[model samples]
Target: MGALAGLAPIFGAIGTGISVLGTIQAGREAKAQADYQAKVQEMQADEAQAASQRDAAATYRQGRLIASQQRAAVAGAGGDLTDPSVIDIMADTDFETDLAARTDIYRGEQQARGLNDAAVNSRISGKNAQKAAFISAAGNLFSGVSNMYSRFGAQAKTTATASGSTRPLYG
Candidate 1:
């Protein structure tokens, strides 16, 4: 019983150390997970941007083909292909096509930005988790040390009383 009592503080310290290590491990895992998620987000954003640019190019090509066909039709019908009305119509068609393509690209860019923001937020959260883990570990260690000292002090008082001493034996 005396031996066990004497060893109690050592055991408590060991237990506290293990708990702190586990906390630190958990923090590291969270940070790794966040980094992976951030990488995935960046990859997805790149893919989306590429797809948007490709679609925009295709839309511009289609618009050009359609405008050419309209001009050819006007020329065949004996209408003045250089007439202001015809020119305006062709220009409007081109503008509309360009607008649609640009809109698609813009939407994709916005989505990519959102994903990037989320990734950043995740990273920040992971860092916060690590900080919390460290704080908790410190608290646990302090509590464990306090308890160990209290127990030792109580044991010393008991021994001193039994020995009929006016002061603690070790002191």
Candidate 2:
């Protein structure tokens, strides 16, 4: 019984250590999960940007095709390509085509930027969680040690009193 009682503090310390380790591990896992989510978001952002570029290119190609058709039709009807009205129409078509293509690119860039911002936010959140976990673990460790010391210290004082010790427990 005496030996078992003496081992109690050791067992308590071990338990505290285990608990602290578990807390730290949980924090690390949370950080890792957040990092993974951030990576996914980043990939999605890249995809959005890529899709926007493809859309813009397609818009440009469509605009060129339309312009070619307009030129062919005017030549067939014997209309002068250099006529002010004809030039205005061609210019309008070019302007509209360019605007549409640029709009697609702008929209895509906005989407990608939003996604990247989200990824950055996720990373920050993950880091905060990890830091909080470590802080919590340290608190637990300190509390555990304090509790163990108080318990042992009380027992030691009791034993000293019973042994008729006159010396102070702490100089």
Candidate 3:
């Protein structure tokens, strides 16, 4: 489905290129073939429109077929999934029984996938949070250390002055 969706742009580009080429040729040769030139331009526009529609139709059909195949594959993969084999059993088995069983299995699979996604997301989220906390704490610790150094220098100056020791003021 995705691949077919992507081809729409490619088809658009091809049509645009063809239309430009047609316009250039029609302009250069209009004096010699006035009547034919009009017809040629009209035909070119119609042709491009038809080509784009046809390509879009083809892409839509291809996508539908692929989706159907995926659904069929899912149905067939499980023995109890309303599959061909299950239908034979359903001839004798209750419809609700078969349906509920299949639903339960599909639900379990979905739950498992959800849990796995949650675990991965939680781990990544926690790691980022811890990293941010560590960075914040480191910044705070650095600031505290800087303050302590300044206070220590002030205390040393006061002690030197009390002891009458001469120290260079500018060194």
Candidate 4:
């Protein structure tokens, strides 16, 4: 019984240490998961941007085909191919196609930026969780030490009383 009592504080400290280690491990896991998710989001954003660019290119190609067809028809029908109206129409078609392509590219870039922001937020959250875990571990360690001291103090008091003495058991 005396040997077991002497070992109580050691056992308590060991248990506290294990608990703290578990907490730290959980925090690390959470951070890792967040990082993985952020990477996935970034990848998705890149894919979306690429797809948008491809669509823009396709749209531009189609627009150019249509403009060429229109010009060919006008010349085939013996219309005034050099007329100001005919030239203006061709120019307008090309301008509209270019404008649409630019818009698509801009939208894709914006979406990528938004995803990057989300990734940053996730990183921040993960860091915060780690910090919180450290804080909690510190608190738990302190509490464990306090409890160990209290139990030891109680045991010393009980021993002193049983021995009909005023001095502490250790002294």
Candidate 5:
């Protein structure tokens, strides 16, 4: 009886290992996909940051150019200042256009990243679901085995009673 108690723990360990291995195997693919998605997200964020910094620099330079042009016109006009200087803000306009274009590109890139993350997460969830189903099936099989074990234990008791040997506590 004491030895059987010890053996029970060993069998439990074996069954637990089998169940966990199945789950790990199923999750491996999902893990790989998630890793890939994470890298892609990182790249997208880096690209967005670089573009934003460049846009800021370009906009600052364009502002300086427009300011310098207005100063030059003031000096060139000989203080008459009669006609309104048609300060074309195409430098600012071009900056606005470039910034808008960048924002649009970044949005599309991030959207793709979001989609990839969703797909990978869905795959991971599917793996977990499959693991759950496997566990459920294993539980059903163990239930059947437990029923057979109980029936056999009863037969063992009857035989021990007839044979005049003391029944073991558990085996």
Candidate 6:
């Protein structure tokens, strides 16, 4: 029993160390998960920008094709390409096509901006997780020390009382 009692502190210390390590490991995993999420968000942002560019290019191509077809149609119908009304129609088509393409680009940019914000948020979350883990580990260490003192301190008090000693057994 005395031998076991002497080993109690060693066992407690080992337990405390394991607990602190586990807490720190959990925190690291959380940070890692957040980092992975941030990476995914960054990739998504890149894809959003690329998709926007592709959409804008397609819009421009379609607009050019429509304009060309309209011009061909006018020529086939014996219409004068230099007439004021014909020129106005072509201009309107060009304007509308440009507006639509620009709108697509704007929409895409907004989406990419949102995704980038999410990525930043994820990275912040990761940092917070890491900080929290360190705090938890410190708390575990303190708790373990307190537990050890309480257990040993109580035993000292008990022994002092049994011996009818007026002096406190421990400071």
Best by lDDT: 2
TM-score of each: 0.83, 0.86, 0.33, 0.85, 0.41, 0.89
lDDT of 4 by residue, 46-161 (tens): 98799789989998998989898988999999998789999999999999999999889888889988998898888888888888888888888888888887788676667765
**Distance from true location, Cα of 109 in model 4, Å:** 0.4
| The 10-residue segment with the lowest total lDDT in model 1 | 156-165
Give candidate 6's whole-model lDDT: 0.90
Residue 90, model 2: lDDT of 93
- Report lDDT per candidate: 0.86, 0.93, 0.52, 0.88, 0.61, 0.90
The number of clashing residue pairs in model 6 is: 0
Off by over 4 Å in 6: 153-171
* Runs of candidate 1 exceeding 4 Å displacement: 153-171
Worst ten-residue run, lDDT, model 6? Answer: 156-165
| lDDT of each residue in 1-171, candidate 3, tens digit only | 989656754655455455545544444343334334444545554554555455555555555565456557656775345567655544434444444445545554555455455545545554554555455555545554554445444664577555555888896
Candidate 3 residue runs with Cα over 4 Å from true position: 1-96, 154-171
How do the residues 49-140 of candidate 2 rate in per-residue lDDT, one tens digit apiece?
Answer: 99999999999999999999999999999999999999999999999999999999998899999999999999999999999999999999
Alpha-carbon error at 48 in model 5, in Å? Answer: 0.5
Query: Which portions of model 2 show Cα errors greater than 4 Å?
Result: 1-4, 154-156, 159-171
Candidate 4, 123: how far from true, in Å? Answer: 0.8
Worst 10 residues of 5 by lDDT: 79-88
Give the CA lDDT, 0 to 100, for residue 53 in model 2: 91
Model 5 lDDT per residue over 1-171, tens place: 988765764576566557656656655655566566656666666666566566656666766666567667766877433444333444444566567656756665665566556656756665665666567656755764565455455664577555456878795
- The residue-level lDDT of candidate 2 at 118 comes to 95
In angstroms, the error of model 4 at 73 is 1.7
Model 1 clash pairs?
A: none
Instruction: Give each prediction's root-mean-square deviation over alpha carbons.
Output: 5.6, 5.8, 29.7, 5.6, 10.3, 5.1
TM-score of 6: 0.89
**Candidate 1, residues 76-156: lDDT per residue as tens digits?**
999997799999999999999999899879978988898888888888888888888888888888887787767776765
